[model samples]
Target: MARNKFQTLTEQMFYILLALQSPCCGVDCMERVRQMTQGRITLGPGTLYTLLASFEEAGLIAQTALEGRRRIYAMTPAGREMLQGEYARLKAMTADYAAYYREEEKQ
Candidate 1:
């Protein structure tokens, strides 16, 4: 079967949406992702802006304001739903890993 668009999020995509949970501009969004991941993830301007545009186009995020050349964005209800789905998928993967490893250790 053909897969749906965004059925699974890339690491960059996931962090970008997570940062947009609150209204913020592109620069702030990059910083937020960096801080949240403890510098493990850093988004360059090119990747960040491109994903922001895509998300806005998909109706997953909405641009809340424009300040000079800066545009602020926040997650829409659709974005939240997407985020929740990804979170659940990730949680389930971890649970499966734990269960498999536990069984391996028992054997």
Candidate 2:
């Protein structure tokens, strides 16, 4: 099977999608990402906008509204599935690490 373009999301990509759990504009996405991460991750306007464009083009997200110049986006069904898959992948990875550490501690 062919791999999906978004099988694995970057830190920026993941946060951007997460920020759009509710409809949000570009600026809202940036600010929410920062807030959610407690300011650890900051997205520049260029990267965020570019990703938004690509994600929209790819059908991962859909534009829900245009409040003046701001374009608000929401995740499509496909996007939600992709995010869920990524979450599962992350869970598996962490579980493996936990198992490995537990065995090491037993030694």
Compose the digit string of candidate 1's lDDT tens values, residues 1-107.
10256789999999999999999999999999999999999899999988988888888899999999999999999999999999999999999999999999999
Q: Report RMSD (Å) for each prediction in the order shown.
A: 2.3, 1.7
Best candidate (score: lDDT):
1
Q: Which regions of candidate 1 are displaced past 4 Å?
A: 1-3
Worst 10 residues of 2 by lDDT: 1-10
Query: Candidate 1, which ten residues in sequence have the lowest lDDT sum?
Result: 1-10
Give the alpha carbon lDDT tens digit for every residue of 1-65 in model 2.
11267768998999998898899899988999999999999999999989998888878899999
What are the clashing pairs of model 1?
none
Residue 76 C-alpha lDDT in model 1: 92
- Which regions of candidate 2 deviate over 4 angstroms? 1-3
In model 2, state the lDDT of residue 80: 82
List, in order, the clash count of every candidate structure.
0, 0
